[model samples]
Target chain A: MPIPLIQLAGVSKQYGDVRAVDDVTLELEPGEFFALLGPSGCGKTSLMRLVAGFETPDAGRVLIDGRDMQGVPPYRRPVNMMFQSYALFPHMSVERNIAFGLVQQGMAKGYIATRVAEMLRLVKLEGYGARRPEQLSGGQKQRVALARALAPRPKLLLLDEPLAALDRKLREETQFELMQVQRDLGIAFMLVTHDQDEAMAMAQRIALMRSGRIEQIGDARAIYERPASLFAAEFVGEINLFEGEVVQSGEGKFAIVQGGGRIALADDTPLPGPVRIAVRPERMVMSHLRAGSYAEFAGVIADMVWLGDLTVWRVRLSDGRLIRISRSNADAANAAFSRGDQVFVGFEAQSARMLLS
Target chain B: MSLVKKTRGVGDGGLAANLGRRLVLIVPYAWLILFFAIPFLIVVKISISVQRDGRPPYEPVFELADGFIGAWESVQKFSMESYAAIYADRIYGDAYISSVWIAALATLCTLLIGYPLALAMARAPRRWRSLLIVLAVAPFWTSFLIRIYAWIVILKDEGLLNHALISTGLISEPIHIYATQGAVLIGIVYSYLPFMILPLYNALEKQDTALVEAALDLGATPFAAFRQITWPLSMRGVIAGCLLVFIPAVGEYVIPDLLGSDEVLMIGRSLWDEFSTARNWPGAAAVATVLLVLLLVPIVAYQRSHLQTHGAAR
Candidate 1:
């Protein structure tokens, strides 16, 4: 197998009492689109900084392109970072900003001009070369930042919350554009972001981080369906948790003795003692009539919210727990349920994941 | 709409409010006219008057008791000899040139020294920044004259600096720094360093550090990043600091008088000599007026260009 483009072997960084990055070890193949997904203070940005050589790891090693990166300053590293704040030089024109990296390398002036034009065209900004950073709009500035970072053609590119400043519509448009650029260049990209939707939409694989530790690493579907822990289940998407004790076990089949009712799973291992079952809101089906095949909970709809494409119903179960169930608005029968109405919220056994913590 | 109508109502209270608003505008205008404009006009009148041996030492051209015709006749008696005398004398020319040269050199030295200090303070941890700022301005608490006096004690031939250098074997003899232009330059730079540092600190502190990081990440070395990013960005502060130091240093009196020898001619010393020793009030006024014009031209040009660029950037 070919060597990985970027690798961090048991890297750790500490800031006073807090450990910003705790023993993070990961690798990205060349031309891979990976994202470090977490909330603020989760050390995702710190991990990216470690790879970019901004913050030296307190322990372990950072390797890029099969070479150890110890004692390497950011200037000498074969990597670039697009900062959260665009960090464009306000005094320089757009063309100058894009050509900055090339000029630093002492490239030929003619080649620098050609490469700057190519980058500007790649970012879809052709005639804005002479304008200063202050003259550009937010989206234009973001494009300029991207162009500037990409001009050097590094082995890997690190982006720290590149779309956090844009509005929703702009963010969505830029997300697709960014993915396209990454694909076109075929360069490894490691994106750091707090927004789950942005990570889900742009990244090929997502590493969920919590409190300076990696909670789980998988594609969006695996992370959403098979969360490794309670934090992962709740952090990625909306999850309805059920506290139960597994009484029966064997042959990938188990029965959970919950306070409200007995839940039997056909596709889960029989873990003894108390466990928490996490079910995604969209996975659970709601019906007015009781369904005997699935593990069902009888409850009354306490709240109903009409989203654009789906309606979420909060059902107060007989055990005094509120379980949220979302139904597609495309179905006419699903709209029959309303607040104060009796309903049964059920989910397939395969959809529910048993959480140990 | 009701609030708008209420605000626009032409009632007695509204009239009183209008008068109060007018008073707010008029007070500062009255102060400028009385304190600044009138005094400036008096100086101009004195600068063109004939010097005489009297209590005031200059002929008063305008008399209120004399009517408008008599005032016109007195205007004819006003002489342009003081301005002509300053123009004809090479001493005044040499003083002007020396003052500009000294001030320009001091400003350059102050910029070189202040830039690094300000950059360091700006990059210091957030908790220590305020303390650093306070320390930078702490020298201002002492009297300016007393500080100059303190410099004398340290810079004299047998003083602390020379003794330390001698003891360290860095010098074989005591340097003749005191009572020279070098001492005056040192004094000016020391006194005006805070002026250079404060504005530079403000500018450097306001910069987004990511810009420097971006420069480094783009393959530029740390020094190159500073040259390409930090220096260009801190130019506004550089200009402000230079003007602050250069303007005052050009017309400085105390530092030159206390630290400089008789050979180091400066316009401030010449003006002082004309006023007290030579007893030439008109000549002194002429010197002061010329210096004011010399400083004001650059100040006005800098302000206009600053405003124009700022407006365009906005």
Candidate 2:
């Protein structure tokens, strides 16, 4: 709606025989925080580099603000990247580092000074103008890198795992700070991270990548609740998978599993042959007594892990199929199901969706 | 506390015993004091000693009773006379000036050539980097005199360059370039080029190329990235290369002697003439002292500046 601040259309990059980024086509709306989430070596960083003009697309085109980026070097592009290592100039002070881009752009000295001061204040590092990068803590260095990348006021800002170097607590704190900055500036931010929780916490939209291709792209909740592929469902969060065959596909769809018998599902799509049903672990209900439901199975608790907030129980059904169920600690405590205890696992028919692939 | 006492007693009985410890350290310490410090003191004493008429400025003559006068008269009577004599000789003066200018020019030439080579060295492929480095430094393993002499074969009147040019019909006659200022400069630059390159290669090699890309990303052109980021970051290498070239270039006598004509005088030749031909020990010492002073000032300045910049960065 806002003219899509950054557009990567069929962009692909190849290193020798290996395709690092394969036919990636995506858009980033203005003022939106977008994330590219994947494990290491999945081309998320390569995608960010392509957008930043660090690496030229081997085949397709990268467009920023509707202008083609062919033959345009990084400095001329209206995009800035914050490297994962922070890449702060070790020789320069905080103020100088922030002012580097402005100085290179030939802004007047006084204006550069004023803008740098304002940016330092924006990142809440106003008084640390004279300190070098090594003198600052990890969080402060991250802020300096952010301030430096933002000082130029590029149309799109690229962050490559900005919080990967920070400790756990610091990373959490800085994630909120980064989100606040992105929102306050109202600029499009493309963040690359392998951490699912980090992506969910920060990005408005996420592109989950695997083996150089986008497995799925959607809002945080959609990607978590309804992944388009088995890879995306498993990668985003834990899910209990039930392998079965589509025995009947009409108004009431049913899947007959190998070990377990037939179970009625909500999906009515014409999926033929074999398919798998995916359900969130938390969506499952576990009890010692067999409750009347659309689908039910008796199983024994093989393992029980008591986290303070939640409890995870591994259930082995009578057909020798394993299913994981997560319940709140209060509920699990009241039930008091330990290992070797028999339990009944049941879920609503509408909750489990049949994945054709 | 008891354990500390026991260890101390053992240390005192073992390697820290007075005689054994003294025996262990005395050889090297005494060697250094005798060979290094005492020799330096002897040179200082001889530099200030007064000269009699017949001897070689080392006659044992004490005139101190006449007003604490031996060293004082040496100062007043000898009184920079050798300095005056050497200064009066226009050849020595011109040679000193030429030496400084030639050394400075050669250092500049070396930097201009070596920087790009070092850059190429730093950017070479991983497998080729070691080969390039070895090639850059391989000239050092060959004899220095041999290398200078090799230039003789290349730059002589009927040498390889002129012969090739003539055979190619580029020139009708051979050109005499060997005994000229150009020849000396070529020789000096060639001899010291590796010195310039090694330091620069070391410094440039240590640079994380990501910094250059960071500069380019921040809106610097390729050349601008090199100037603002690469060059300043490699200042340590530049200083080291300049020192490596300048110090030896100023005192170099072999290349000039072998490559240039007698008309081209340098401080090294002047010092050689004073000692060998002119047989003026005091005058040669005076010239050597002048050369020493000339060389010491920049070395001190360079060290100070290097320390200051390094300290600031730290």
TM-score per candidate: 0.94, 0.89
DockQ of each: 0.85, 0.58
* lDDT by residue (tens digit), candidate 1, B73-112: 9989988999999999999999999999999999999999
* Pairs that collide, model 1: none
Off by over 4 Å in 1: A247-252, A260-271, B1-32, B63-66
lDDT of each: 0.91, 0.85
lDDT (C-alpha) at residue B298 in model 2: 88
Error of 1 at B157 (Å): 1.6
Report the error of model 2 at residue B278, Å.
Answer: 3.4
iRMS per model in Å: 0.6, 1.2
Misplaced by over 4 Å in model 2 are A249-251, A267-270, A292-299, A316-322, A330-335, B1-40, B49-81
Best by DockQ: 1
